[model samples]
Target: MILKRFFQRSQSPARSCYEAIVAAARHPRLYADWGVPDTLDGRFDMITLHTYLVLERLKGEEPEFRQAVVDEFFRDMDRSLREMGVGDLSVGKKVRKMAESFYGRIAAYDAALAAPGDGLAAALARNVFPDEEGGPDIAGVRRLAEFVLTQRARLAAQPVRAIAGGDVRFEEPGP
Candidate 1:
């Protein structure tokens, strides 16, 4: 009993943060008010942005905890793929694709954030806006880029204890 109590591991906090990020990404303002297309690709882009922000904020933490969060993120992705009917045989390939996409976006978002004068906006446009239709929604992309930066700042300001305890909160979107 003492061992169990001493070594208790609570996964809820991390999972809750994951859930919160997803819900925030799924907010309707992103789709309706901000004009992020309410399509699969659009949704994926939003989630990726949120995930990237979280991962960035997690920098400098204990490696194990950070990796635990990443593992959970991929576990969620795998489950989502299965639920969405990605075949068992193809799931690996799809996950590989997802990981590649995640890594690429991380690099891209890092560069965009570090860049000046609408760099992040341009990156957002390139990723979230479909090429087959209208050109990037520059205005909406601007808002989302700002949103990403704002969230990144807020997350950095949070204490690792609070974050690990699932006490994270995202700033509300602007009008």
Candidate 2:
């Protein structure tokens, strides 16, 4: 399967996986905890993870750290694709596309965050819904904030996967 090729070429999936998990967990927590509403569909955990991965890449960490984060991100994305019944090559391609899109969004978000004023909120709103206005709609902002918190929680929960893998596992709040 694709995992075989991915592992063979990449090698040491564990280290890479661990780094990705850490990177994904590094976003600002207040966003996720105070921002997202109780009622939304889809898991924000993945989005938060993607954000941290992008930030880490931007920071220009060592190659090993970068590769590990990328590998882990792809692995988790592939797992999500598989669960959705996507085929191997398709999953690989889609994961790449998703990563690119995610990176682009992260860059945009970082730029916004660096700027003065409440630009980050506007940038996030635009990123989340480009078709709409620049500022975050009520729900979109909430989701973004929630994602930040969730990412922090995920990282905190999973300090070490082999020892605490259960911590990173996504759990939806009760309706």
TM-scores of the candidates in the order shown? 0.87, 0.51
TM-score quality measure for candidate 2: 0.51
- Over 4 Å off, model 1: 1-10
* Candidate 1 per-residue lDDT over residues 56-85, each given as its tens digit: 888777556567666777888899899999
Cα lDDT tens digits, model 2, 1-175, are: 9778867854464444455444444334423543332221123333533535343432543455445555665676678789989998798788778778667766766676567776655655555444434543666565554554454455445434332222233334222
The segments of candidate 2 whose C-alpha lies over 4 angstroms from its true place after superposition are: 1-60, 129-136, 139-175
lDDT at residue 57 of model 2 (Cα atoms): 33
Q: Lowest summed lDDT over 10 consecutive residues: which window, candidate 1? A: 61-70
User: Can you give the lDDT of residue 169 in candidate 2?
Assistant: 38
Model-by-model lDDT, in order?
0.81, 0.50
